[model samples]
Target chain A: MDSSQRQLNRSYLLRGLTDGIPIGLVYLAVSFSIGLSARTIGMTGIQGFFMSLTTIASAGEYAGLQVMASNGTMLEMIILTVVTDIRYVLMGCAFSQRFAPNVSLLNRIGTGALITDEIFALQISKSGYIKPFYSYGAALVAVPLWAIGTYLGIIVGNIIPEFLVSALSVSLYGMFIGIIVPPARDNKAIAICIGASFILSWAAEKFLSMLSTGTRIVILIVVIASAISLLFPVADEPAKEAAQNE
Target chain B: MNRITLYIIVMAATTLLVRVIPVLLIRKEIKNRFIKSFLFYVPYVTLAVMTFPTIIECTKSPIAGAAALVGGILAALKKINMFIVAIICCVIVLVLEFVL
Candidate 1:
């Protein structure tokens, strides 16, 4: 590529990294709890941090920690991780189309490593063609932040008293509510979907105690989502309306 | 490899594969109706599943955890910033933990 082209790609990477900062910070907070919990379950700091560094899948990691802590089998944990993270397959497909046709294979893999829920939403929401460099920039900023955050959680959690730490962990649940509530408030369909998941999850856990946690959650999500979508499929976002207005 | 080692390796590899396959293959937003609709609802459902029952268990006391969760939902509903909402949840839990 020409010097100007390379410069432009550099700028894209930088911009993506800038956008990634908030996401990384939030991830650090959530993963902090994961680190602490992993420690509670007997994993060393390095082991927990390495897991965070590689996967960056919050729910899957947390689920894995819980399973491991409970003397669950390796097969159980791995199956749970894959089940909880199956959404990444969909996210990956959506993002694959976003990259420019000519972006190299290695760049694709590097950028793809960072395609979490928030990153995918942010990248897809952008107006222009996506440069692979932009994703690389974002990943570089977010990934290390997540790894360090997990490590710090382990270190700090070891020092803090459990009650205070438990108090801090409340914020994790708060974060999830913060994410789901706003969107649910505006959209009736999303509200009902959340409600259904809540009821089913509680019921499933209570009645289907025989089923594994991972299996219960997977069934809850897929059954509720599929049933809701079949009964009432929400219309797609209005991409065309905005284009006309513009 | 031991079970823990094997578990970590499998988790990392499969999760990586899940994130890689679509980016390497699909060129656009998926057009399949079943997959599209299913994907659309996955986030909300997953979050809800994570939140309920578990949220009740996050704090030192059920009262504190419930209070913080209600506080968070109300705060977010009022269009409060998430960072602030998180802080509010922590503060509510801390204070309630002291009282309860």
Candidate 2:
């Protein structure tokens, strides 16, 4: 290959590696249990790893594993997965808007394949319009971390001590708290957003047990809370700017 | 089809469906203020809604929940590293699970 081509490849690899590191660590912590859970539910190692790779969702994967373990019908799996992952529909909608107009259809679809919560967070943190290649760069890093971690987890799942597994599993929740608590501290409005969404989610699970559609429930709750926030955004922004100036 | 393959298809289809529609339909560069603002906050709401329930569901009993609450408080205060707090909570819960 030409030097220019080699340089391009090297850049892609470096970007993937950098992007993959934190995300890979997270995948290691979360997908380990997912792999372990898949095995406990009678999935072979190959199945478990591929499931993690293809699904790329934590809650959706866990829920999917539960349904499969119970010998849920194909229809049930489809319904439950679609329901559990419907939040992604909204996530995808939001993330896609970040894409510049020039991003191609093929690139959008390909990159959209990798738009999980963590990836979305990381990608959005970078400035300027979101490019399809950047998503690919991130995915090139993240996808394998997820796939490989699951593969290893499945292979050695039975050997790992339960305590260690529990600890690793807790990291998933930790990652969430890490994401939520920081911004939540500075912005009362964001905190309110989190609280309202939490209550709605809890109520949906508890009182609306008849509506066992997890994704739909999340979608509805998010839509409601987001709509409310739109109407009544905390009037502190200009006030804060004024206070800061003073 | 096997269950695994079925799952792959469903996931692939669902993902593509969610992503491709707007890209296809909204050919004009979407500059609508309302749509833009709505998109910005949707992710936070989605993330919080998804995360809150899982923390509760992970803990089997009140003690674990209590420990998690402490861990969560510590995390919120940023008193300790998030990873360390997470491990501490998990260890406390594991011990509680063992003891009670």
Candidate 3:
């Protein structure tokens, strides 16, 4: 309510927006692929746009597209989307610790809705309690680019060259590598977990070929993370601060 | 309502619930060590699981995808910013696709 409080919130918002620029750019490339897929499944541009707007999740949206392409029922759609996005629950739990205790119910709901993998990674990487406004700021930039990119991809419909599309397809993985590798380098335990995940995930894909992608991910996360935690429990401290450093 | 429209709504609601419920419920700091540790390591594991094997299938050539994977890891290990690491991987894929 006070001028100083307003100024502080504005600054957090600006910081989030600034940090979110690269994420927005990457979303443009990734969601373009999503849009292309949507079009292939016979979705209109407006439909693709609304889908991206409502579900700012790459994997979840992709799974939904596949389900629709198969004329899968609502039950199938619900199951697949929930399975694909279950990671967000873990992310949300982690983020819950990061929020300032006084963050309102409305702010919590708003910020929680925007908790994409990239944004969650950025938020937890910061050193202190997080403000809802920061998440809001990032979403303001990144979310629009995502929805618009999907719209454009549906409208543009693969007019982009094949070679360029191939190149763009790997950007999301590159960003994922960027997030995990630095932390892995710093912590031996994290590095080991990542290495194990690489091998185990590959094995899961090859051997569990019948399982859906989302199912594989959840199973792997539960097995690997739980096993590693048992072997090397993080030292006693507030989980919030530990997550901040992680 | 149209079928695709209904699907979109279902998908959006499912995704939203996964994200929103935890923050709304877990207001206090978790004190359990294993649970805390699991949460701590969740991001690294989740990101790694999502990236690998899948990344190898994303590009035109599996070889290009593998090359990009190696290049991305090396670039990221050098403490490169995310945007640069992504661009480098894309370039690696582009050139590899051209040649191979």
Best by TM-score: 3
Candidate 1 structure quality by residue, lDDT tens digits, A1-246 = 889989998998898888678667767766787788877767767777788888888878887777777878777776787777776665565456456777777778876777776666555435444567777787788888888878888777855566776667766567667667776676677788988888888888899999766567767877998988786675564223212211
Off by over 4 Å in 2: A1-16, A40-42, A63-77, A125-128, A131-134, A152-156, A216-220, A233-246, B1-16, B19-34, B59-100
**Tens digit per residue, CA lDDT, model 3, A33-103:** 89999989889999999999999999899999999999999999998888888889988887887778777
List TM-score (chain A only) for every prediction. Answer: 0.68, 0.74, 0.90
Which candidate, 2 or 3, has the higher DockQ? 3
Give interface RMSD for all predictions: 3.3, 4.0, 1.4
Point out where model 3 deviates above 4 Å: A238-246
- What pairs collide in candidate 2? A83-A215
What are the DockQ scores of the candidates, in order? 0.52, 0.37, 0.77
lDDT (tens digit, per residue) of candidate 2 on B2-88: 766566566556544654554445445446555655555575576666666656675566566556645765665574544455556
Worst 10 residues of 3 chain A by lDDT: A237-246
Model 3 residue A193 CA deviation in Å: 0.8
Candidate 2: C-alpha lDDT:
0.63
Would you give me the overall lDDT of model 3?
A: 0.87
